[model samples]
Target: MLITIIILAISAIFFVSGKIRSDLVALCALVALLLCHILTPEEALSGFSSSVVIMMIGLFVVGGAIFQTGLAKIISSRILKLAGKSETRLFLLVILATAAIGAFVSNTGTVALMLPIVVSLAMSAGMNPSRLLMPLAFASSMGGMMTLIGTPPNLVIQDTLTAAGYEPLSFFSFLPVGLVCLLVGIIVLMPLSKLFLSGRKKREDDAKSGKSLKQLVNEYGLSHNLFRLLVTETSKLAGSTVIELDIRRKYGLNILEIRRGDLSRHRFLKTIAQKLASPDAVLQANDILYVTGDFNRVKEFADEYAVSILDGHATEETNRNENSLDFYDIGIAEIVLMPTSLLINRTVKEIGFRDKYNVNVLGIRRQRDYLLRDLGDKRVHSGDVLLVQGTWNNIARLGRDGTDWVVLGQPLAEAAKVTLDYKAPVAAAIMLLMIVMMVFDFIPVAPVTSVMIAGILMVLTGCFRNVEAAYKTINWESVVLIAAMLPMSLALEKTGASASISNALVSGLGSYGAFALLAGIYFTTSLLTMFISNTATAVLLAPIALHSAEQLGINPVPFLFAVAVGASMCFASPFSTPPNALVMPAGQYTFMDYVKVGLPLQIIMGIVMVFVLPLLFPF
Candidate 1:
């Protein structure tokens, strides 16, 4: 018992450090318990193969497919479109929409998807992102309360009930208290709550930086690298497509655009140009290719392809037409370095960033200072926002990397990929099938099997382009964290530690009356959740709540609900939930901000849930 306590204490220190990875801490603790004979090998390894873990993996794939297909972005546009310019309307729309989506999806994924859109919307409406974000994080939690799978705690308690020979909660059982809690949360986070948030760029200010793309045409010296080539009938490139030519990879050059008719404006020239210039378009005779590359490769490509180089730079200063090179077609996006990004503490030059990624760093935003120049030498830090520039193809791929970098928002002009755009319906269908199979139990299928089918279908139906990308979409850290933490709950119960804790609660707090016992259950669960994953907290306390109920000779339902409700009240700390972490960097929220706002909400929720649980469940 003492060894277990010592192990957990050390693990908690690592979890709160913000230096070591949480998954690593969990793994170390697991290995320690196994070595100390606190747990058998089977017990230590059982968590890895748990149904809950598998279900989360399936959900991750399904969620990634939906995200990649731009479904979330489409929803963002439709809802915010109706929100108009009123911050109040936008606030309501954001909370309602994020909550609605989060109930069906991972809250972390929901927040990651919405953060960019909300930030952009807040900027457009001239409001600080923090004002909209706090409600967003809170509402996401509330949304998870609406369904069995809304959050992990709901599932944890439902399964716990099932294991104890009680009927598991139905899918919609969370609706009653969840809906009421959501309404109360909405009231608490009204627009007036903005006073507690940080001041940032207003809507009246130039929001182009805070809102959308900031084009820097000459920043990367791309002008000097631009070269125009005229392909003749004898050119080797005349019969090939841009992708087939692979000029970008072969010679380290970016083909900016392809123009046909060679400065001839016969009106048909526009039609001819349209057919031959896009990245997928084929090359033809009389085609003029606008390319950017090193000077040596530019000359080599022209010579090898039997093409002629156009002397002097093609600038809007010289050409007055639509095809004029006036800093157009440049793609720049803001990406924040993930706290766990490997690129941290290293200079951009040291990372071989430009050569490796084929993107140029325009500026770096570290706290208050926006370092535009001298970026290559400056060491990058976690949470630093970067302004990066590249071709549309190169820039769009950055959106796929949710692990190392948090892409702020996509540029307005960049088109969604044809595969992802078209596959949205397929992904939606798979998700529906998974939900129905789990809910209906039409064929007595295991819940994990349905998720597995959905995950497999997501990849098989081209919703995810490849297996590697599908794997990349899962948050391995989250998977490891949850899987590794499961054994601790089992160990606590096995060692009689959980019962000891529950006995203390019944003897000490329980003597005050059932209401006081309810408060203790609620407060204990809530406090544990603020510092650890809510799912782990629910697993630890749900049984203890049941044990307490047995001692008091009342229905366990109220106590169980208290555990669920209290565990979900993870608003008081930034690290309490993944949604909170996702929004912290984007909203520029401080720790005190969470305490100032979330602490009150947590206390209020405890009081409300404690007061109402007995009435709802009838102890």
Candidate 2:
């Protein structure tokens, strides 16, 4: 008992600090339990092959297939267009769209796909990307709250209820409370969000910040280099094509890409400049070109040609040649990395970033509260914003091409038009059917098995263009996290720790009856969700909650519902949900922002579940 207590205490510390990877922490706990003989070796490894584990893998494949096909992008574009461009309109629309789709799909998957588009739209609208990103993330969470198929937590509860001899919940069983919670959450977030959120500056203004780029970079223990050149209307380069631009010969430079309109790059055109049609290809006002060359050459070229270099870099000494720095209405902005970023503890110099990504880390956004200091010398953190300057095209392209990097609502070019395998819809339809069968009891296969089989069928049918893409879609972190944590949960039960904890609660709240039990269950799940993946939290707690029911001599319905609701309330922390993580980069939200909005909502959820669970599954 004492050993189990120590392990539990250690687990709590791991959960709170999140210093080590959660999966590693869970694995360590499992190993400790196995070593102590609290659990058998087989028990320690069983979670790796559990039905939930199997199902998540399959669902991940399906989710991957959908993304590979670009169906999510298609859906997001249509929704945003319909939502109109107003910040408030877009917010509600995104929430509604995400919730509606997420209810039937994977929340994390939904967020990952939609987040890029949301950021793009916010940047286009000249609105702070953060304002809408958080709402969209929250929407994904709420949408999944509605159905058993909506999120893993709901499925866990329904499955546990089934195993305990209770009727499996219907697809919409949780809709009433879920819908209420969703609406209340949105209503509460909108007004309060502005207090912490700031709108991003306009593109024209950002273009004007070019001079300040150097100042920004200097703060990061880095320096910015500026260049100014003219794309004369008569130059063959101007009329011939972007591909034909004599970057290496005339300018002795590298053209990262060009931002013509909102597009990223065009593969068919060979080069970014080539994509512009003959007449329209002429360089017009604000036709900025991002080139990589020496700062001296850039300065000499600008001096000889009489073009403006962004003035943000100029100060007293530099101002002696201030006339040389032309303010061409061009600007640059910096975004900081918060402590949570994977980049934290890693430096741009260490990453071989320039060679690897072909983009310079011009400036650093400090991790501190204000924009006054640059993060140049400071290590990057999760929430740090980077003040980067490159050709608008290079900056945009860099963010998209790199998997490890996320762009903070920077305007970039359009995506290359690639012929998509339209069979994705058919594959998606089939997968949807599988999910429906489980929710409606139209099929006998477990939800996990059904999703896995659907994924296999999707691959077999070529619903996905390639098998490799399908494999890539599975969030391995989530899979590992779930697999690792299950063992520890089982150990807790095997060691009599779960029973001991449940009995303590039962005794303390015995007079309060099931209402008390429900709150404890709900609050515990909610708290866990804040720290770990919702699915992992649900799976880890489900068995324990079920076992606690047996020991307490009560029906497990209330307890199961508690776990269900608890796992869904991840609004309190960015770590609470993948969707949150996806948007946090672009939205520029701080850790405090999530806590401020999510904590209250989470508290309200706790209060509501206490009342709702009793009504839904009379204790």
Candidate 3:
């Protein structure tokens, strides 16, 4: 017991300090328990197989499909249209919309989906996006309180109740609590946000101005380097594969795309098929290759291969014709290098974007200046934003390497705008079916089973672009954190630490009444959550809360509800939740901004839930 207590204490300190990843800290604690023989290997490993972890993973895929198909944005944009010019109305709608989506999706996913829409709407209404964004982040957490699968803490409590042999909560048991939270948030945040978040420099608007495709092309001078070359019957490049030619390596040239004509029975009415250039693509007579390189290199390659240069500047055409850059298969995006990216200080040639990631670096944006020409030998610096063009699949692959760089804005949103919007209805229907299976008792499917089925259906029904895309949606860090921390709760219970803690609480506060005990548990959980993950906090406190109520001879439901509410309601610090951290830069918020705006909301919520929970669920 002493060993377990020491391990828990060390882990808590590390969690609070934030010097290490929370998931790593939790795993180390789990391992210490095993090494101390406090838990068997099977006991320590049980968390990885827990249904709460499985359900969370499945829900991530469901939520990803919702965003990938653009269903969430379509629904959110339509609902926000009602806000129409009233900043107050828009503010109310932002919270409601974010919370509503958050109830069904992960709060992080909810905030990400709603961020741009809220920003655009706030700007249109002449309101600072800062005013709506913080509330937007808060509402996602509030919304997560609405359903069984809404947040990890709710799942922890549900698992705790079931393990104690009590009747488990139904899907909507949290709806009332969530409703109260949303109402309280709407009432409290309006004035607080206006007072604290409204003061921002005029540079805010300029910061939000992300570049468009045409702007990127012009800014990079891609048009100057871009040219069209036609392969003739006599050309050596005809009937050769792109890899066989090795133009990129041998001639310092990149074939960005290819346009070929398909002749119909009426030869004059031939249709052109555009394909993003790939290594395996076969060159044919009359094929139009969209190439980018230095003028001398392009000229030499054209001469060597007997290929004719069709136009020096065919990219200037603005029509939706065969000559323009087609985004159907290929796209361009900006990626900003992290301070620790291995590619930093490495020249473009050494990094080999084409050979390594199958993408072309069109230009680099370093602060105010843009480097467009002779990019081969340019040494990359930290914070350099590179404009890259490739197949959307390849661009998305680049985005997944989060340690090296961050793909700016929403690449999925951009892709959905052109290609995947047709899948929105399918994704919406799958989500509705999952909700139905979870909500209806007669369906005979468990909530976790329903989530798993929905996730598989999301991929099979083409809601996501591919299986890998579905898997990419899951945040492995949070999943592992929750999974690894769950075993600590078992260790506490097995070692009698939970009972000891509960006895101390009961001995200290039980004489005061159930309300005092409830407040103690709620406030303790909330305070711990501000430092560690809410899910981890809930896991550690839930067994203790259960034992406290059992000792008091009152119903344990209200106490457990207190645990969930407290863990989910953490808002005084930006590091408390993923949604809070996500909005910090975009909203131009300082740490004190969260304290000034979020501290009041967090305290008010605790006070309200402490009084309101027992009324809803009797002690």
The lDDT values for all models are 0.71, 0.60, 0.79
Checking candidate 1 for backbone clashes, the offending pairs are: 126-203
Any residue pairs clashing in model 3, and if so which? none
What TM-score, to 2 decimals, does candidate 3 have?
0.56
Q: Across residues 60-106, which tens digit of lDDT does each residue of candidate 3 receive?
A: 78767776766666765675679766678878878887898889776
Candidate 1 lDDT, tens digit per residue, 1-619? 7888788878877765646776788899999999999999999998799876777677667667776665555555666679876777888889888888777765654665466567656655667778888778888888888888888888888887888898878888888878878887877778335768745543343343333331333433444456778788888988888768867557767665666543344321112222224345788788778776677888887888788887654543344243244322345677789899998999977866456566667668789776754556789999998877665556667776447787665553332222254455666676667666655635597767877888898788666546877897677776777778778777776777655665576568977777888889888888767644678778888887787777888888888888888888678766577676556655656556777788888888888888888888888
Supply candidate 2's per-residue lDDT for 19.
Answer: 68
Candidate 2, number of clashes: 45
TM-score winner between 1 and 3, please give it: 1
lDDT of 1: 0.71
TM-score of each: 0.58, 0.51, 0.56
Q: Give the candidate number with the greatest lDDT.
A: 3
For every candidate in turn, the CA RMSD to the true structure comes to 12.7, 14.5, 10.9
**Which candidate would rank higher by TM-score, 2 or 3?**
3
Query: Using lDDT as the measure, what is the rank order of every candidate, best first?
Result: 3, 1, 2
* Comparison by lDDT, 1 against 3, better one: 3
